[model samples]
Target: MKKALILSTLALLISGQVAAKTWVLTDTESNTEQGNWHISSHQLNIKSSPFSIEQTVLHGGKQEGSKLLVIKSQNGLTITLIPTRGMDILRVEGFGVRMGWDSPVKEVVNPAYMNLESRNGLGWLEGFNEMMVRCGYEWTGHPGMADGQLYTLHGKAGNTPASKVEVSVSDSAPYTITVRGLLKESTFKKADLQTQTELQYVPGSSQFSIHDVLTNKGDYDHDYQIIYHSNFGQPILEEGAQFLAPIAQISPFNDYAKKGLSTWQTYAGPTKGFDEMVFNIAPLSGANHQTLAAVVNKAGNKGAAIHFNTTQLPVLTLWKNTDTLKQGYVTGIEPGTSYAYPVSIEREQKRVKQLAPGQSAHFDLTYQLLHSASDVNQIKQDIATIQGDKKVEEISTPMAKE
Candidate 1:
């Protein structure tokens, strides 16, 4: 099956439509294609059609009018982009594997229908179905009353909408598909933040890269925090699945997590009341401070890897929620500047970022979709090289309040 899927990917590369064109899907400033915009291979004007970008709106329920972009690449890769939900990546297909989960919340939900402050600040879970979702601009972590403000689980970023969206293909070889969006978090008399995120991937490759430039549009220097909640489930996560990383320091987020410290790097089958466990890790890196982390299936033949740099995102949070699939069985390989506790604790720990007026922060990360044993094994070897004789610091006690 793996060989056949790989061959199909190669065939897609060999037989794809190549074109150099830019489409303005949505531009609030220029007054361009803004409402329920869509295009197909026929309208794209590309010969033989190696790829196509299409946008459409979902109907009914909480997903009403949710805008989704389905981008198909030349390497037989396809990804669904949600503009209505902070421009998150919904799902991935091809590449000898399927990257998605059976989230009970089946809607590409629009933010208009979600009450982020409901359910005692845990309302973000109402539409939490994406594969990758950014978790902050002001603050993230769990929800709590801190500094006289009620901070919600994660933050407003995932539930926020992008102000603008665009798609373009490279003019030359590689023909990288770039999906760009601008997400803003602002309110009256508060911190005003915006991030221009570009998700780019070559047509014939099994990986994609994210470039984000977050700027404080407000005059005041206010605190901000962001965590990339990259999640996986099903085929890549199961009983006996392994979480691999080059660790510099590791500790449990709470006492419950500490109880499983011995098997922290391992996963289990879904149990009815398993609930969740979280681990905080300071990862080791190679030259240029590059870090890698991944989770492979029980057989170790398939996996997904997150490539990042410690310079921008220095903290890693492993979230194990291997409960029943009906209750959203999944794992989050999160990278952030701070651990997820509460906003007050993050501020006290100095993990929250403060940007000066006109100052911006840059972040770069790549998602490599691994399919075969060779690819998965290669990543394991690369991680081992990064560890390179370093002693890992393991903590037995709880590191923070959860």
Candidate 2:
């Protein structure tokens, strides 16, 4: 009986030690654990999942009074969005690498402080730095009067807050977290527009998807335009970084872009007094109407790529500004339904899309961070294949009437 009792005690002690051991799966490719771990125990068992979504409010500074949703995946991707800022995605991080530019304004400022004055008013540009700053439903450009009505810079979409914000997580394999926000832009007896925006992230992947639906809820036909002004900054947009796209044609929007046309694909270190340049590009499309563009850092072996539907968003704008290194140094890769020019110009060109009452349009875009050198190289090769045997055509900018 004594020997049997001692054997039972020994078995219990052995099991406890075995359960206390931690087991982790190391990623051979990256030589890291990548957060896949599990611990066994008698009292409880804990395991780490591939993805997580969290919501929190930012306090103090410019971010005061802002509710933010943070989505993280095991693949080292993290995205931050502000529901108060028209559900705009403010920041994207992957593997300790920031994929967006840092705005001068440290916090997300309240829209109450928006300055809409023409000559002196800055509108949303005052705090314009975001991973994705949505433009439109109305006008998006310099402040001007269209049809005797005043329009501010980039319109009011970014300033309009969202309602019915929801965050949902999937329980099945390949777990995904999705956040949805509904924004209404309207005025009594005037125009009414409802924009439904969603951000989705999947586990074990460095990509996030954005889906948006814009509807005209007014009685009269309404002009609608939108641009996803996605920006990339340092480390990704550094001295050795390059912009790669399957462009069929490139039109310079100003004399500055024309003068530097030879070096449009190359980037320069931030310089003082550098004028911002804009280019309108027609991207080569695939059979399914897919298009791709990327900004790659050769030195850092990192890159950021965008996959979008060219049928829905046919125009691509590249805005490069090194004007003020400390204050405003960024490269913007914008895909939109219309050019970033004034609404009047788009109207004259018959490019302004009118949404009939009760009609809606949908847009989809995906951003992927290339964490591995091989992944970056693969994208570069793809862009090369698309540009094969064809030279990039340079055309004059479409003139806007005075």
lDDT, candidate 2, 1-402, per-residue tens: 122223323433343333222222222344532222221111122134455555666678666766666766656577888777888888889875777886787778766666656354355677687888888866676556678777676778887767556655443333355677778888887789999887766545567777899999999998888888899887788776789898999888766677767778878878888888888888886546776888888563787888788888898988888656577778999898877777777777776788999999998887878777877777777777767788888776534432
In model 2, the clashing pairs are none
| Tens digit per residue, CA lDDT, model 1, 1-402 | 123233333433533455556777777788766566655444645454377778987899888988999888655678888988998999887777767677899988899999889999999999999999999978899999987889999999888878889887755455556788999898999879999988876665677778889999999998889899988998899999999999999998988887888898899898899879999999988877888899999898888888888999999999999999899889999999989989888877778988999899998887878888888888888889888899888899866665
Task: For candidate 1, report its TM-score.
Answer: 0.92
lDDT of all predictions: 0.83, 0.71
Q: Which stretches of candidate 2 lie over 4 Å from their true place?
A: 1-50, 118-121, 396-402
Q: Give the worst 10-residue stretch by lDDT in candidate 2.
A: 37-46
TM-score each candidate: 0.92, 0.84
